[model samples]
Target: MKRLRTSIRVKLTIATLIPLVTAIALCWVVGASIITSRFSSQALYTVETSLNSAHELFLGEQSRLSDIIRLTSRLPELAENLSTSGPTASVAPLRLLLGNEHLSFLTLVDRNGLVRYRAANPSFNGDSRIGDKIVSAALKGAVTSGITVLQAEQAGRENPQLPGKMVIRLKATPHAYTSSKTMEERGLFLVASAPVLGSDGKLLGAVYGGILINSDNRLVDRITSVVFQQGDTDARVRGNATMFLDNIRIATTVRDEQDKPAIGSLMSEEVFAAISRGTKWIGRAFVLKEHYFTAYEPLRDLAGAVVGALYVGMPERPLMQLRSQVNIIFSCVLLFLTIIGVTLSAWIGSKMTRPVRALADGARRITAGEDLPDIHVDSHDEIAELADEFNIMKHRLAIREDENRALNHTLEQKVMERTAQLEEKNQQLLAAQKELAESERLAAVGMLASGVAHEINNPLAIIRGNAELLEMTATLDNPANEEVETIIRQTDRIERIVRNLLTFSRSGIKRLSLVSLGILVDDILDQVGHQIPLDQYRIVRNYRDGEIEVEGDEGQLRQVFTNLIVNGLQAMEGGGMLTVETSLNMAQQQANITITDSGPGISAEQREKIFTPFFTTKRDGTGLGLAISYGIVTDHAGEIRINGEVGTGAVFTVVLPLRQKEVDELS
Candidate 1:
């Protein structure tokens, strides 16, 4: 404290070390950040690309099966055998092809959607596949292929070996959705179907085959081979590929602690939920007992419903090891450079001390107002350069001061722009919330309808049963006979209404059959008198020369046509003409049934919402009739069209496909 003398060398040393240490720290921090970001990005990209590759492989399997089935269906000999001797004669050729193609199951179905032959079990035949989506589509002249989940019984029916292979023991998994079952007995298959057509272009039948994917490692191994290309002896260092049926791993290349394929292990709940919502999940996730960078894409059915997921993941350990190595190398380099910097700073500080003392002495002389010659340094050094740079630094500092003010002004404008963007985001959030609310409302409605239908069905069945007993017990000429009959009829109507509600809620068709549209319309017309007062209205029928038949659920089609006919009759409150016409569009192989009502028509807005559930114009209407009808027609691969303006009366047209064969006696 005598004078607090600080040497120029000390000052110069501090100045040199301050910026050197700061720069080294910055380089370390920035370099680590860049390394981590690049590695993470590359990891994510690799996982996503692997997922895409796995998806293509899955599709490639389906395409291969599709080609096989399509080519098999085009065989003239198979078609001739099917048409002449039926599935019995065609089995030999099919069995040979089945073995050649390595299919787990191959079936021949007639145009009526009935399984006529089974390559796996020749004795098992004549089972109806009318409810099978792939077979039904194939019968309708479409070649179809997709990943399908089959019930254990259905899989066993295809091939007895399939059930055993499909059975996977479920293991306890972390962060996965829990299942009530201990094992997944159902089979997941890559299935393909094609229509067997005659030389004249007529649909003869359909041929369908499938390869079971449960416990199959070939596809996932192929995906890994193609995507990773690195044949590592260590399984942990290799990539993982999995195909999930919902949340269950039906096919996978990932292994468990026992070194067996984790076939039945479940995926994380977060990934499952994301894929369930039809969104891709790409990020780090915990798989099994380890963390991994994963990418998952939803695997959809032919109907576009998210049925499962395709997943690819890289082990986090390898990536972490790489990052750790990079960091270690950086740290070592940083430490070495730090040591060198300190040594150089010490040397430079010693060199500058002499020159700095000379400058100090000159400054003191100038301050004392002593006239002196220009200060001279013997060597060209940093101190000599600093003397020349002082005036330029002063000018640049002023320019930076002005730039700071302009930057502040620009930042304020940017804040305003950001505020506007935030407002727009808020508006988007509100819209999304509104959509969510609407979805919730629809879900609630479905639950209510289902509950109501269930609660009403038991009492309804009892009432209808008692009413039928009373009708049967009473004499035909008795005074109470008509009343009993009416009671039974009215109870039946209530049952149909309940059925409509149940169908609308579940959106399912119970059974499929060949229905004659003309006969169905006539039957509804004959029965309409009991339900509606048709005394004031004139009904006209314009049916084709012959009955037009279509493949559908008879009861569902009855409901659809009855609803349309009844709606047409009721629309004419003032007693107008109701016309029903049926025709065939041979080119499209479709039947068109048109119902025209000569009364007030539907408005454009109402028409748009007409098929939507719970939207009705009538005061006493349940608003589920058209909705149920629409679902039924769509399930049957048909459509309902309304073509009429306000005040012009509504014309309802129902288009349905013609059945290629008689499906009534298929069973």
Candidate 2:
């Protein structure tokens, strides 16, 4: 098994990051733990404080009821009427007391515990007493303050329940035919009692008054308003206050999940049990359908027995959300720190490896026998000392290399001299081999052309002789004379094709002369005009309005330009420009003629075979014209080449060496 290789940078990064990541992870763990614990504690404290505030307001309300009841009993007019007149008393003073918005129910009972007056139900004044602990105690001449569930028909039970003030139905109800007073259980009240005595302090009757907190308003709203004030926390999340009589939630600002008043739901079993024991349960508890950070305090009777509980709860969702937001902020901070650590790690890695990389590169250069610049040893360290030693070794090696080069230089000179002589001989041998191959190729082609020409010449001679006979012997108006004329023309074309093949195969010579290329091109075009559709093309002669003389075979040069021009004209199937340009090539001591056409151009593949004997692009071509033309140009010590692309057209250039002797004669 192979272990992977690492550079100095990787080692440095690993060494740095292990401790960095470990420290960060440790810090993160500790921070999250501390933050969550603190949030839990602080959040509970807020809820408990709210609960305490609500409880204080509730107690104050109880005291206010106590004050109203005790104050009414002390009224001088009330004591005088009740004592002198009893059950049939005027009772106008008690009516005035019940008018207080805070007071929900008010009554006066005689010493026999019979109702003398009822403020809530005025027509039922002589009804049986509203017997609760406070009322009972009050009738017994003992002043009391407490929460008591008034008897049916006492706490406005006899008063018809309005259709609009419906509570959530929790229990089974009596039949519709059943009397509402017989089946209904009235809700709880915060009541106060004080004995009504005569002016002599003799017990005459008792005044019982209370504020009903059942399905009640303003009182619970006041508790919530006092406990939770507006701030960063939303009022809905601040949650509302609730009071429960035993298991029944009687008066509340708390709402169900639907946002309606949660007037009929019970407390969680844990919270209910704890409050039933008359102790505060402070923490998270499920009530209704949601969870809250809550506090529950017992609501006791005047005898100091727990009969109900006062509760304040703040919804847990907001507290948990704030906690999550804090955690996210810390997480983002951790992420930023991690990114910084990674960046610093990379920088430190580079710093550690940079010098080592430079040293390795320098060593490689020296080992390969390359001259090296001096390395600066800026550090006062062992690495710097090592660089100094390396520079000394490099200097010694450079000196040794110089001495070795001097010795090798003389030996290399002798070898180069011998190698040059050998290369010259090799070139001479290759030239001779090429000449021999060419001579053999020419001999074979000539033999084949001579045989084919001889066979065609016999028929051509017979055809020409017969045409002459017809021209001399045939009479005018003979239709056969026209056919005979056509025969002569066709035979002449065949004869030219045979002549071209022979010239190409034999590499034939011609009479050399100083020729005007302009006159020669014009003569060739005049001859071609009769054979081709010359009127279908635009002939552009750009011969520079002067004569440029060149040393060449007059007959062969004419054939070359003629073939080029005719090929150009024939290629223009849709009728196009045919240009013949002649110029002097002063630089190369030559005269140039160019024939170009606006026609479907020659391609690279076709150009290669254009001057090859027996190869042609045309359907009825003997393929000998350009071959003979190529041979004739080469024999005259001149050059010819085709230039073309796929769609632009073709230009054939013939460059003939100028005659220096002819130039001197002309001058």
Candidate 3:
């Protein structure tokens, strides 16, 4: 084991594995810490928020109940009539009133602590605690209120011998009629109670009402339903929430899978204790055999006593799923970073080792006095530069070796040539001198063509300008309009021909200037407009919405466009469309202008030499048009290309750089 560990391969493996393992371990530790802290904080915040919302909802329910009570109390006639009428007559009107108010039961009691009237079905006979807490308190002239839990089974048994059964009970305090009685003997009921007062500010009687909290699970279920819906389903209440009075469960909105009620179940001890403190609590706890993040807030009565609690919660499955997804993404990122680091380290190590090996080999060759070969290295870093310097040193040694070989060869030749050679060498030198003169003569003739082209260009420009001025000023109504226009047009054509000649002769301006392509196109079109039949050809312009400026000579570019457009018009003897489009080129800081013509396109064989000087297909054509255009554009550091198909016509694309100043500012 020790020997295996000490091996170089094992050591290298350990070195690589140790760091990667350490990094992965650290990533997991950090990720877990963050996840735990953030998840706990988010859970706590969610619990607190839900508790607050439940408290507000409970308070709203109390306020709604109070509003209904107040509305009932305003009917002083009903209270007065209930005190005077018999039990049967009073029961019908009271039942109607209770039904309208959405109360489960309504009752009226006398001051003697007896139930005089009851609105609910299945009579109580005033046997229960009819005038209990509320009645006693009201008799003493104190407004009394309290909520009570009523079991449907127990309450129903009281009326099992009657025609129908009552599923709930109600009780009131300080009976309606005036009588002497102790508060304890009033036989008050186990339900909510309220005092019925008269306008004279005297205690008229009491009105008691009770709702089967267990039967009204719909309200709590609706409150606990999720506010937002996802996927294809609507939001729903997923978990149970039970209202607890003191330590006992009063009612619950929980339902089984079959939609059967799961009420009357004992409340959890932890949740009960939390509510008893009169402070809100929330955390992961089991509800209906499933774990959830449950929120509980104490419900307070008018006197600020803890009467019950409102509970709301949701399952933690969604949060667990989210945590799993985050872990997967983190793992992927770590793996990607690890791969990149390994690749970079290996590449750098190889890069450092290769040059050192080459440098050592070159040094040995130089020491041996052998002709050294060139070494090539391709990095713009310090190590590459060092290798470059070493190569230079090797090159110097190789030159020295060559010179020594030449000197040795000369010495041997000298010994052999001593007898007879001087006369023959002089005759050979004369023949070489004669050949050099002939080459110089041909070079002089080429220079003459450029000079002649320059001399002719100036005269042509002068004649063209005068002819244009005359045509512009001349009246069109004159009988000589056709003749004069022809002269002007022909002069412009001659000037274009001369400009091409100058380009072929290599005698035009060498300076680049900012020239707007839009203006250049307009000038070229104007010069060649009359030459082409207007009725036969259609010209289309698709220029972009700005000045298309480039660095080139305006006159030379105008000559280029003039030649292209005229050739396009002549190609389609039957006439066709000539489309010119312009836009900016992204990578090349230049303007791209393309001219396409719907004419018989160039054949593949003719396309190759189309830009060669003096290569024409027409009898009267000088064929210098495209060639000179190509040369002039090339001189401006621009590119021109021709794309054509046998049947689909041709497209010529010219790309010229923007002026240096514009390019610099844009950059």
Candidate 4:
């Protein structure tokens, strides 16, 4: 009896505790996933908000600097005195002007790319660092902006005498001042530059001015003081933020801790590369042996060229400590819940086991073929009722066994019939799904075909008009001949368009061959350039020196380039610049060809549907250009990336892997 009771107790205990344990385990897993996801999302939001704030600050500073440059350029005495008195005489006034809290070092570079004058104490003298790209660009009436690690000689000081002297220079055209001369001799530099126009609206020169970031300016001190302030009594945290001009770290509150100024320290390769690529980055970085979450953005001058990068960083340790504290609190709560659940399960299991064990023992006696024994129950409960039922069941078992078998057979037959019905319904559902897919495909194809047909008709009309003009002027072979030739070329382009349409509509892989990209791009440009209105737009090509070869269908690849170029032209309805660049992406082992357009950029919502057939933003657009181009590129096992900002313009980059010799041979 005791053995039978124990068996029943074990079964009941397992039944009660298993489900409770499972529920607690599932709850823990779900809770952890939710908390982790929330934490990650919040972290990303905080970073994005901080970056936006930093971007606004950068823009404000840029505008303020531009204003200073404009105001200072109008000062007639300063320009006249500096120009006529040679390089040495300009130092005193420059030093006085730079004495202002916001002004940095003053520089005067000539058109021949020479730093003719600098304002640095007794070391002020004329130095010629001619043939520099910035000076050349400035001479050509363009603002040259970029960050560079200033060497001792390139620091704008004549003697290189000033210890740890570095400056971020903005070179611009000088306005019409009394000392105004040629574009080269009159080039001005301060911090920022503004174009100076004469009363007659004639171009004169540019004026430049800048704030000295490294000096004991109150602005820097104030920002640090507020953010690093601790409790009362004027105490503060020992933290600092520094500014880097070019690759050189110039100004910082923490400079005193270091043995030497960080003014000439070269930026890390990663940071330099990002700035060069015009990309802004924000993340944790180790600077001066301390980890900081740094917000970095490229600084641009009036011409929208990146001159320098601004970095605002705060120590990451404090934020990490806070995160750790949160994690600890969460872990403790989870641990407490876990302990409670385990304890409750143990108590409930013990309570359920006793009655279950009694029933189990009674069942075992019947299995042992003993005369049925009456079960004695301590409590009048469900278990006691079950025990009485078991005794009755054992008495009637021999008589009811045959009837039970027949009932089970009938249930099995019904289950088989229901299973067959479910299978038939599943097949019908699958067929419907297939038909829906086919309908979607046909809709897509129809839209693409309609747009392609419409786009081709316009060019076809132009071709026809040109041919008629040529036919009428057959006898005249001068200007009219040239006009006829131009017409024939346009007609050929229309034919190419029709060919691309047919290729796109028919979905089949074409034969590919190993082709040199340099030659391929040149050939496509020769054809597509004639189609675009070149007078309104400029095409800037930035292809690498070496051959970029890949396995692809030449005709199909030509269609892809044509489609992209046409799309870019269509985007810039009012005419703008188009930049096509090619380079090897070493990490990805692919050649990246990027087409950038200086037009209103694509929105995020629009970008999602850009490759979909027949989706277009333009009234007269066929939209199949991008869709067909996308298909061709995908067929070649390549990836295409489209990225843009609303006002900044758009870039479409295609990455195709380099073809191996073996694969090329096989093709």
- 1-667: candidate 1 lDDT, tens digit per residue: 5989888767777777788778877887887789778988999998988888888887888899999999988877668766874446345778998899889999988888777888897777878997889999999999999978888899888887788988888888999998898998887789999999998889889999999888888988888888888878566668888889888998888888988788889999888889999999999998988999999999887678988888889898976787788778877887887788778877877887776776677667656866555555566877776644543544455468668888899999999999999999999999999999999998877755744453344335445554665667746566457556656664665665566555555555345667888887887787666556678999999996578888876766777887787788878887999999999999999999999999899999999999886788888776767876787787667889999998899999999888633232211
For candidate 1, list the clashing residue pairs, or say none.
none
Per-model TM-score versus the true fold = 0.52, 0.51, 0.44, 0.42
lDDT of the candidates, in the order given: 0.80, 0.71, 0.61, 0.59
Tell how far residue 519 is off in model 3, in angstroms: 99
Models ranked on TM-score: 1, 2, 3, 4
Candidate 4, 243-308: lDDT as tens digits: 544444445443323443333343455665677678876665555545555556675544566656
Kindly report which residue stretches of model 3 are placed more than 4 angstroms away from their true locations once superposed: 1-36, 85-88, 126-131, 140-145, 151-192, 225-240, 245-266, 276-279, 299-308, 356-667
Residue 555 accuracy (lDDT) in model 2? 55
Ranking by lDDT: 1, 2, 3, 4
lDDT of 3 by residue, 1-667 (tens): 4553243333444466568857886887688678867876786577667666666665566555555554555466556754574453454556676678666566666555566666665365454444356556545554444454334443343323111222212212121122232221111122345566676766666655544443355546555553211232211244445565543334555554555554433446667667777877678765555566778777665446776677766666666776788788778877876777566656666666677678778788778877767777777887688888887766665568668889899988996686347657777888888888877776555444543463344335545554665667756555456546656655665565454454544444443567888887876665455455557888898898467887765656766777677777778778899988889975778888889999888888888989876677767665656776787677667878889888888889988877543221100
Q: Report the candidate with higher TM-score, 3 versus 4.
A: 3
lDDT over C-alpha atoms for residue 401 of model 3: 66
Per-residue error (Å), model 1, residue 30: 0.7
Error of 2 at 433 (Å): 99
Candidate 3 weakest lDDT stretch, 10 residues = 181-190
